[model samples]
Target: MQYSVLGTTGVKVSKICLGTATFGVAPTAQDADRIVGAAIDLGINFVDTADVYGNMPVFDRPGAPAAADREPAEQILGRTLRGRRDRMVIATKSNGIVGLDINDRGLSRRHVIRQVETSLRRLETDYIDLYYAHDPDPDTPMEQTLAAYDDLIRQGKIRYVGLSNHPAWQVTHALWIADDRRQQAPVAAQVKYNLIDRSAERELGPACDRFGLSIIPYAPLHGGLLADLRVLDREVSGDQRFQGSGFSESEIATAREVERLSRAWGLAPYQTSLAWLLSRPAVASAIVGAETVDELHANATAADVELEPAQLASLTALADQPPAFQHRAGDGPERPPATTSSDPTA
Candidate 1:
């Protein structure tokens, strides 16, 4: 039930953000209701969704599923929000695919404007609490993207601006442009961060702190890598939805430490992983997707689990190895300025 302000936006969000990449699929509206309802019961007020998040469990791949198969995650989430709109902080992204046309994607002015309007309609809301540029769109100039967001803020279509899967330099660069131009700067940055994957800590973490931008880490469980790696050895259920966060030799080494610490703390590996993420700097919230109501409740209760300072240090030291692998997006020192039609944004 703990909460923190989203960067410097003065908006309070739950420590655990409910990620809806699995919506409209396995955990359909009926199951989604149970999961989201449990999250609300446990005090989760932050929810993250992307326009191209339907049909599958995750969206890190590009163009495999046709446009017809991909349903907007926002639409599914929007329908579920019905009366609970005011009870949660709603966040959705653009710069992803809504159609097969060339102009249906990217962070260009035309695309951003058109996407936001459609998102507003599909979300069944006049304003989105937070809006994100799904990823780095190199084709479009940064100023054009910022200007589009600026207009949205001015028009009351979106309150705060943010980015997902954007690197440290790109974030700082955008902030520089926004500050210099007196435009609305981003309040948050979302990335694939978890106990097993600490790449964002190298540069993005420091940049976020310096720019007064909070970090909303998606895939906080590392595709169930932090959830539990036993499935790698033994054929365990619930490993399908988490296949995106692949495993590696070094990652398994760190995950072993996570299990040991979890045992000592008397908590599940997933819960311990989430608690560790909540303890990081500039981390406003950590987004975790749950398949069932029980899973949702378990993940939400991680907010109450606090690791001792020494314990956290030990966990960090174990996870401080070289980048072995990443969730869906490979661990690269520099992520190219790329935004795809399949914005699973997981």
Candidate 2:
């Protein structure tokens, strides 16, 4: 595995960050152990989990077996990471539905602080290397959230602040406040960025560039659509990973073409898709999740795949064509050609 500095954070992490959404959702405790063990064995030291990523939700459904444990992802990681926590950068998020209580969710001052404590307890770690606001909370003031994060930093509860599923304008405003208020600035952001959805490139991409923040894209494979377009035939429309969205016929065809094009380039569709994503500017890491070590290894090894300039340009040109639905596109800087600085660290 190749390592890259996580956006402005001095700490270096693997290009392929291991996402733990599958911990209790898919894999058994033994399976989770092997997957994490395989990741560490492969030099992937970045592991991402969420406070809400428990067995409560499985395969996009909310009805997990009552016998399953809560916060299984973190609990499992805490158990599996014994004597090895120092070697990895552990990231987890809050602001999602973790309970039925009124204060169980959101990025409010009370919730952020409360959730971090719970997260720390579950992970069996005192300090989170990176803690993210899972999503924006319109109910709470941004200042309240930022101030809470500031407190966490001072207390050494978390080292870096990041956000996910935030709009570009909101992120920009938060950055401005952090700088003007003299608070610890956010070091990274996450968004749904993939070959099929370049919407993030329009605003979040450029915004991160201006703020010197890293963009960690989740769902690089569009929740298995790009992994294998054939999965679409299964008709499992509500796979939670797709975020309540499904690909159109045209989108499927486009994904198929991308997969076919990859073989001509001597790579799997997933590998080619990941390589293209990693080559883009502003990307610090691509978070991929899997139930088994073999599946994880297939996606993680894309770090070794590189496309020639011409091949990359060809792929970009193909993607430039409008997709089935009006995919989000807006004014922003053009993505620079892939280069050595894709994950540059100082």
- The CA lDDT of each predicted structure is 0.78, 0.78
Residues 39-76 of candidate 2: C-alpha lDDT, one tens digit per residue: 89999999999986755544343433342454467888
Query: For this target, which candidate reaches the highest lDDT against the unseen true structure?
Result: 1
Query: Candidate 2 clashing pairs?
Result: none
TM-score of each model, paired residue for residue: 0.87, 0.87
Candidate 1 ranges with C-alpha deviation above 4 Å: 56-71, 230-245, 322-346
Candidate 1 lDDT by residue in tens digits, 154-222: 999999999888877778777867877799999999998887678888888889988789999987887
TM-score of 1: 0.87
Candidate 1: clashing pairs of residues: 59-344
lDDT of 1: 0.78
